[model samples]
Target: MSTYFISDIHGCYREFKILLKKSNFDVKKDYLWIAGDLVARGPNSLEVIRYLYSIKDRTNIVLGNHDLNLIAVYSGIKENKKENYFDDFLSSKDSDKLINWLRSQSILKINEQQKIIMIHAGISSQWDFETMKACALEIEASLLSNDYPLFLKSVFNNKINYWNSSLRKIDRLRYSVNAFTRMRYCYPNGKLNLICKKSPNVVKYPLLPWFIISNKFKEKYSVVFGHWSTLKDTRVPSAFFPLDKGCCWGGQLLMLRWEDKQYFYQSYLG
Candidate 1:
């Protein structure tokens, strides 16, 4: 069985299906790993969720920032902004079921046997795999708890841009989520530069992509990540694989077959 990894689909269900067909993906024999941003900014967010849910057993997903935002909006913790692209999903009869399933997904997926890790964004240099997994579980627990809506309400309000084990509960969870999902650039000291969405070449001094800052971890394992569309290409300094080819922004939907490291693409149909 082959494992295929894709990221930043952003609700382009048509292109997603096209790529699957092009790759000759077998639902029963192949496994699909999504790096995240499964829904948002495209025309068919609802359809994407439903389709993935139907194939849930064969799919592994890490929650992206957009996925978290969808949860917050669904739970009434955040406003549903115009560009968010979740109206159909929110209005659907299966909204609660879909959101619940989404909430159950982790922010980090580690395959120890393959020595590969998948996340929506990059992990911090400060964390080894075990430590990162522990932090991810902390946030996942909150997401799965009875007070998840409260957790969502509090998660986005904090400015704890750095990691500290002594941080309060909410702060710790927020920091973990940011590092696993929203982070792109960070200072050499590992403080996240959450505002700079530009490519690494254009960013000013003292800021580097999280992978560049976390060289040690990069050397140890292959990492699959998305969420930074401006990355422009998939190559980085280490075994880091970037899959967000900006499909939501008129680029191509990309997939990497993990066994042989083959890359496949299906361009935007618009």
Candidate 2:
């Protein structure tokens, strides 16, 4: 059985199926790792979640920014005031189960045997695997616990990027969520620059992508991540990689065979 890693599906259920087929996925024999963003931005999110949930035992998913956004919108963390593109997921026949499944996913998946590191957005350099896992688990508890709605609502409204262990849980929750999901660039002092969504090399400030800035993780592991939709088919410097090919924007969906780094891509049909 081959090991496959995918990311940033973004609710394009059709694209996902196409990629699954193109990759010749062997559900019983192969391991599938998803780097999150499994919902929102396209059509038929509920179907996507249901299908993945049905195969939960064979799947590994990390939460993407859009995935968390959908949860936030549903749980009243952020306003559902924007586009109602994912209304089907919110008003679906199985919204509860779908949301529950999404909330149950992790923010990072590491397999030392494969030497593969998976995450939605890139992890900050200051974060070693242990620190990253701690932050992710904290938010996971918030999403699954009794104060879930409160956690969701507060996760996106605060100042993201600051890292203060002395900060309250609420503030800490917001920073952790953003860094693990929404962050792109940051300063050397571990201050996040959430304003720029463009490539790291061309940023106005001298800041770099979290991984690059940290200089600690370059080539340390085979990192697989999704979320920067513009990174489709592009390779980053220092063995950094991006796999979110913007399938929701009518781009290609991508999958990587972890053992050999073999790749498969299919056009989005959403």
Best by lDDT: 1
Q: What lDDT does candidate 2 reach at residue 118?
A: 82
Task: List the candidate 2 regions with Cα displacement exceeding 4 Å.
Answer: 81-84, 232-235
Residue-level lDDT tens digits of model 1 in 1-270: 999999999999999999999888899999999999999888899999999999999999999999999999999988998787888999999999999999999889988888899999989877766778899999899999999999988888437789887888788888888899899988999898788888876778798888887456666688999998899753587588999989989999999999989889999886
The Cα local distance difference test for each model comes to: 0.89, 0.78
In candidate 2, position 195 carries an lDDT of 72
Q: Which candidate ranks first by TM-score, i.e. highest?
A: 1
Task: Provide the global lDDT of candidate 1 against the true structure.
Answer: 0.89
lDDT for each residue of candidate 2 in 1-270, tens digit (9 for 90 to 100): 988888877777888888889889988888899988887777777778889998888998889888888887888667764353677777778888778878888887877776677888877666766777788889888878987887776677536577877878888788888888888778878888877777644565567667667545556677778888765444477466578877778888889887777889988764
TM-score of 2: 0.91
Looking at model 1, report the run of 10 residues with the lowest lDDT sum: 212-221
Cα RMSD for candidates in order: 1.2, 2.1
Q: Which stretch of 10 consecutive residues in model 2 shows the poorest summed lDDT?
A: 231-240
